[model samples]
Target: MQSIEKYPHYFNSIKEVHENIQSIIPEIAGAYKNKYNLSFPVDINLIVGGFGSNAYTYRQIIPNITFALEKLSPNPDHLRVIVAHEFGHLAQYIMLDDAGMDWSKSRWTHPLIWLYREGIATHLSRQIADNIHPSVYFSYNDEGVQWLTFAQANMIRIKQAFMEDFKALTSEKLFHEWFSINGGNRFGYSRLAYFLGNRFVLEYMEKHGEQATIIAWREENFEAKIAQWLSQEGVDKSE
Candidate 1:
């Protein structure tokens, strides 16, 4: 009701987003299934007027995915990238579950865990939905040039700032600063940690190979390793 009242002008655009999602999700799901060589059925739910999340994975009871149409763009490329991104999450969960990962032991509350999860999902989205403009993977819109450029130019400073927060032991504010849409006080860009996470995943893949990087959180020192990456102590700063 509030969303309907707040932005009545966007209702038509939201409807178009719904239509685009319906048309494209099957193809996106098929691509991910083939790329990962997995046969699980994809369950997608369309929604509106929620908490402004573009899309999210619901892992309780069953592996279900939902997209908030009002929070998404009507562009087909955006739909493909976001849909594949959610499914990327599903793939990560299923792979770990099938491998007998102990859910009770997982560090579900840590910032590092969040970083790795989003990073791997973002990375997988680009791979499944290949050869589009790079900004789509991060921004979900064609107008994300500024966001990407800012993040790329300030990699060292961002990583160092994150490293400081990681060592502070105050995770609630840290998580919001890095991951939430409402945060930008640090660098004036929300979800900058998503970019940082993707960079960590890319480097980890280069060093440790694919499967290991996907399940890197399983190791006990996962957060420590992520902190080390954020420290960037001796690493090259000019990229």
Candidate 2:
């Protein structure tokens, strides 16, 4: 893909971002290698005009790896986190393969998959970025500022609940459901999905290694397994 000099002027130049993203790969791989003990190819693409100004994994038959950025040099700390997060996904994907996941036939809605995909990156990204909140960030502000208002509220709740407890926020069934419900374009829902998935996996990491977590995430019935996570878990549902 031709490099679109479209790196938002509010951030760094495309060339700068390209260098940063490229240079971080070895450090990223090394971090996970020591933590999870696995290796995977990391090929990222710089794509703007995406639904999110975040990094994500591109799934293909061969999984041509990708990690997108909303802006070239969005807050340096955030950029570092996003890159590390996407790289985390690459690492987890390799772990999933080692565990014999049947990705080609998988439905992709598995909640555990959400956690594995979003959480590992989240956990690692926070570290690389030296972030205070391991899985959350704030954008805008104000009530009429719909996105900021909601995110701020969610952040408060997350810190009170998930940040401390973690298990209370972990759920496979509701993860994808929230993804669809909050994702149309109307704001905070989709972003909330990212943090939810991450928090769940960060907790999972404590109990399971990367490979085991990936396999569990890819399991066909995790959504069903996590069916009652919301109503019974006791995290404010008033969002």
Candidate 3:
């Protein structure tokens, strides 16, 4: 429920981001409460540096939500989407806790599970964005447009290559290769899992309703459902 901003020395002059985060926090909190029935009072820290475009959520010892402002797009709408996305992770943490699921145990090590996590968060974020401003759901200027476009264009080839190689790889190796920018076989894009995860979520939402999708996050059989859905949808095969 508390929003904190930690600016790097280089970002001392930035003042607008504070106002921006302040404006979006209530909206995100409201959406989480309405959609997931969870009151998220977690401390959200916006910092200056991180790895990817999305805000990072740490759930190990404590629930920490950190957003790397430098990594996010400067567009205000885009920033709102990022906040919703990270808050979706916060919602997941609460749901997982209530369900008695220990994410750090062994499930965190699985790449596909990570894909589902990211995908579900992406879906919820889009839902929140749509509720706030429908236009921003998939804005042309959004970075996700480029990633989704590239993924769709190359899905056939990417899926083909993935199935061929996936059988021979370990979970850790597969996770890194699919997610790393320097892996050198990403079909000219990194974070292939994000795109795949998004598609998986879309398929699930289309078949089931949004409520079902939201409830699946806390289900013990969520991973099994993901595997079954992938097989049923033939994710590894050409359409």
Which one is best on lDDT?
A: 1
- Candidate 3 local Cα displacement, residue 15, angstroms: 4.7
Mind giving the per-residue lDDT tens digits that candidate 3 earns over 1-239? Answer: 11234334325433455556677778777877886777876687876554343467774523668876655555566767777877776676666666665554536655667777777777778777664443233331355556556666676566555544456788767766775544536466666766666677777778887656654655665777766554443533211
How high is the lDDT of residue 54 in model 3?
40
Q: Write the per-residue lDDT of candidate 1 for residues 21-124, one digit (tens) a residue.
A: 88788897788678887555756788875547788876442378888888898989888898888888888877777676777778877788889889999988
Which of the two, 1 or 2, has more lDDT? 1
Off by over 4 Å in 1: 59-62, 234-239
Winner of 1 and 3 under TM-score: 1
How many pairs collide in each candidate, listed in order?
0, 1, 2
- The TM-score values for the models, in the order shown, are 0.91, 0.62, 0.73
True-structure lDDT of candidate 1: 0.81
Q: Which residue pairs in model 2 clash with each other?
A: 119-198
What ranking of all candidate models by TM-score puts the best one first?
1, 3, 2
lDDT per residue as tens, model 2, 1-239? 23334334424454555666666666666766776676665455665544344444556423555555443343345455555666666665666677777877665644435544565556556554553442233221112245434644564454333223334434543443344433424333444555555545544555876446555756766654433342133433221
Write down the lDDT of every candidate, Cα atoms only. 0.81, 0.50, 0.62
Q: What are the clashing pairs of model 3?
A: 1-41, 1-42
lDDT score for candidate 2 against the true structure: 0.50
On the 0 to 100 scale, the lDDT of residue 105 in model 1 is 78
